[model samples]
Target chain A: MTDDVAVLGAGLHPWGKWGRGFVAYGTAAARAALLDAGVGWREVGSIVGAATVRGGYPGHVAGATFAKALGWQGARAASVYAACASGAQAINTARAQILAGIADVVLVVGADSAPRGFFRPADGDRPDDPDWLRFRVLGATNPTYFGLYARRRMAVHGDTADDFARVKVKNAAVGALNPNARYRKRLTVEEVEASAVVADPLRLLDICATSDGGAAVVLSSMEFARRHGAAAPVRIRSVSTVTPRFPNTVLDLPDIATDSAVAVEPSGETFRSSIARTAYEEAGIGPDDLSLAEVYDLSTALELQWYEDLGLCAEGEAAKLLRAGATTLGGRIPVNVSGGLSSFGEAVPAQAIAQVCELTWQLRGDAGDRQVAGARVGITANQGLFGHGSAVIAVR
Target chain B: MPRVLTPVVSGWFAGDGDDFHLVGTRCSACGSVFFPREDVFCRNPGCEGGDLTETPLSGTGRIWSYTDTRYQPPSPYVTSPELPWRPYALVAVELEAERIVVLGQAVPGVTVADLAVGMEMRVVPGVLHEDAHTTWTTWHWRPTGVAG
Candidate 1:
């Protein structure tokens, strides 16, 4: 197993359509995390910022922007972008700095002020770009892909629309307790059924919304944590940032076609499963050892997909696990106790870090109403566009 | 004004009616195929390098999955704002020979109701959008044996 980095502090700016710029949200979350960590801004040796594409130039160089906002004291800085996995990439960057002894403490931040309605490609006609081509050629939006997955599960695994609704119902119930969540009201299956269909087999309620929010974390070396009197801080044991193997058979976002398996046989292991597997291997732990999980629930149905991908259950048994209440709080293993993206919507760059924040909170027993009992180990899984695979394992 | 018919993106597909097929590139060394036609290089990691040649994909495949857009998509996807929005069905078809899944819009009027996974679908040419001067053409997927 790799050397562990301590999660000294975790914080968030509540998610919603707050009509503010990303910098404001990110700065707030960073300040909160610094306060929680009991560390001064000048004390941080480095800063890593997860970038957002929509925020113009400042968003691209987010590390400097955040550093400047936090009153720079010559802290080394880095910025990264991996679509939805941007936050995880930032965390990994901080962990690397801590492990490499380049920095004793690193501040990692991610935030986004998302656009309304559907997430669209940048304005202009660049036929060479697959993201633009999908919209121009087929008018396939993000929800369209979610619908395809949900329907595929129905056809292949016999997952019904009701099963999909149960995920939202369960998450919303827990989300109601999370002050950081955007949607707090518990939903019913009837409500989900009555919602407008954004994509077939997936209703508006089944899908996550785009929101403006931020999340941040403070990472430090184990020695640094103990010296700071954080004697038993929750530690990050692994961060898996993997890419898909060649001949990726599943059709993913922004692509019109899957890689042909003519030259190479399919790996059988999907990109998502491989992400969790890599994390498990690195952390020297397995799914059975997990106290809880925080997966990218872009859609309620997709959460079920992650359940199987994370090895929380066997293939085609995600729905059965959900039906058995195994994934709900007080069950064998609770998933998405932080309300997930279903409750938080999506803050893009901030989401992966936010998942880790939730893990830290749960592991520390700081999640009051939504805390899992005696939570000791947690994992987070998410996939970014264009073949970015991310998962993290944390232990208390 | 008379309208001109043009492919939305050139070199991705060619021909007419039943003769039409999506164009892809095949690696001479690795035999790997790429859609949206990779012209520069082969994507296979195991192969050192190879010549990528334009190849026509299979005319038909079976549906891997299907879904429909119930809401209007944002800009860059041309639509008539003056007219009421109409949703369209999209299908991901798994080609048997090349072992690739290609996605396309179903023929106009075909909704999610008519589609089922594993149903045979064939690629056909269709209009993506029409302007005062030209009709932008793209590929569509239709169930095999059904007349369009």
Candidate 2:
């Protein structure tokens, strides 16, 4: 395993549409994390921000924006954008700096104020941009791709609409306990069934919504953690940021076609599976060691796909495991104990860090009503648009 | 009726009636093929960089997967805001010889209900959108049984 980076503290602003700037949410979350870690703004060696695309020009350079808003500590700053995995990539950057002895303490922040309705590309007539080209040529939107994957699952694995709704039911129940989740009401299968069909086989409730929220974490070297009188803090053992292998047959975002397998045989492991497998390999652990997991449930069916990709169950067995209650709270292993994107909606940049925050609480025996008892190890898996992969491993 | 103007990409198809073909580039280096015509460079990393030539994609292929657009897609997609939204089917086709999957719009009148995973489909021309000066054109996938 790589040199461990201790999670000194975790924080979040309750997720919802407050019609406020992402800066406010990010600032609040940052202050809370600083307070949780008991570190002064002047004490931080650096700050990294997950850039938001919706914030216009300033949003692209989030590091200085948040740092400037936090009163300019003159700390080294960096901004990163990895689509939905932006937050996780920021944390990974911090961990790299800490392990390399560049910083004793660092802060990572991600927040977003998303637009309502279907997410569209920036206004333009450029046919060269793949994102714009897809819309102009095929009218293919994000939900349409989600629909394709969901339907493909149904055809291949015999998964039904009920299975998709069950994921919503499970995550919403967890969200009800999560004070920071946007949609906290416990959802029922009936409610999910009643929701309008945004895409066939997937309803409005099955897909995540865009929202305003923020999450932050303070990370430090192991020595710094001990020196700060927190010797037994939760440690991040692995961060996997892998890319898809060539001849990737799975039709991912922004692509109108799959790479021809005619030239090269496809890899045995799919891109999603590789994300988690790389993390496990890095941490020298396996799925059996996980007490819980937080996977990107951009859509309900996608979460089930993660269950298989993360090796929580054998291929084609996610539906069986879900039906058996093995992935629910008080079951064999809890998935998305932190409400996931299904209930939390998507704050994009803040999501990856939020996953770690949940793990930190669960590992610390402080997750309250949604705690995974005796939790020792946890993993978070997410894939970003345009070929970015993210996963993290943490242990007590 | 006005004379049909060619779409932005050319030689992908020609003639009327039974003579439509989607054009693509075949890598002489590794024999890899790409749709929408990759003229700049071959995408295969392992290739020794040989002559890249334009080739006609097979007119027919089996459906690898399919989905329908249930909502009006956002722009650069040119749909009439004045008109009511009508959904269309999108199919990913697997050409056995080309060894690649190409995505296209299902022919008009086709909906998600009419599609199966392995149904046979052939490429055909369709209107993308129109302006006072020109009618934007595009390629679509139509089931072989459907006559134009």
DockQ score for candidate 1: 0.90
Docking class of 2: medium
List where candidate 2 sits over 4 angstroms from the true fold. Answer: B1-16
Name the TM-score of chain A in model 2.
Answer: 0.99
Off by over 4 Å in 1: none
Model 2: interface root-mean-square deviation in Å: 1.5
Give Cα distance to truth, residue A358, candidate 1, Å.
0.5
Query: Which pairs clash (backbone N, Cα, C closer than 3 Å) in model 1?
Result: none
Which tens-of-lDDT digit does each residue in A1-396 have in candidate 1? 899999999989999999999999999999999999999999999999999999999999999999999997999999999999999999999999999999999999999999999999999879888999999888989999999999999999999999999999999999999999999999899998899988999999999999999999999999999999999999999999999999899999989999999999988999899999999999999999999999999999999999999999999999999999999999999999999999999999999999999999999999999989999999999999999999999999
Best by lDDT: 1
The lDDT for every candidate, in the order shown, is 0.95, 0.88
- Give me the candidate number with maximum TM-score: 1
